[model samples]
Target: MNTLTDDIDAHALEAAWGELDRVARLRPIHDEDSYDHAVALMNRVLDVMGDNEQHPLAGLLELLATLVGNYEQKHYSLI
Candidate 1:
């Protein structure tokens, strides 16, 4: 069972979440514009994360990557 949520501080989480939301507006990748937006957001996260896999926004970076990847697979998949 995942205990990650068991010890979270709600107030701190809210503030941090708000900050992230202010920086990047993430959503499901769809058309070219959405795909470009996701890529740009991913780059923004990278500016903060660098190569550290344990950074605070690592999960957010991963999520952005997944969104971009899904869109790429749908549109640019190599058969």
Candidate 2:
């Protein structure tokens, strides 16, 4: 099977990630549904992880926050 060390290339990497993405609870926010999902996930992560930077999921929390922030800035901006 094609793998990362096989010189598989970017297309292979994307294809592998796409399979996971299909079942992923969190992904890039493209619309309201995705936006809502990301927000809910972030909230849950916040509740469980809080502001603990050393927590294993802190990076995930940060990424989810960034996704939500970017979406809001694009869709809900007053400017």
Best by lDDT: 1
Q: Which stretches of candidate 1 lie over 4 Å from their true place?
A: 1-22
Write model 2 residue lDDT over 4-61, tens digit each, in one string: 6888577988987888578556678999999988988888888888768799888888
- Model 2: lDDT to the true structure: 0.84
lDDT of candidate 1 over 1-79, digit per residue (tens): 7598878989999998788668676668769998998998889889988889999989988888888988899899899
lDDT of 1: 0.86
Superposed model 2: Cα runs more than 4 Å off: 1-24
Q: Supply every candidate's count of residue pairs whose N, Cα or C atoms clash at under 3 angstroms.
A: 0, 0
lDDT of 2 at 56: 86
**Candidate with the greatest TM-score versus the true structure:** 1
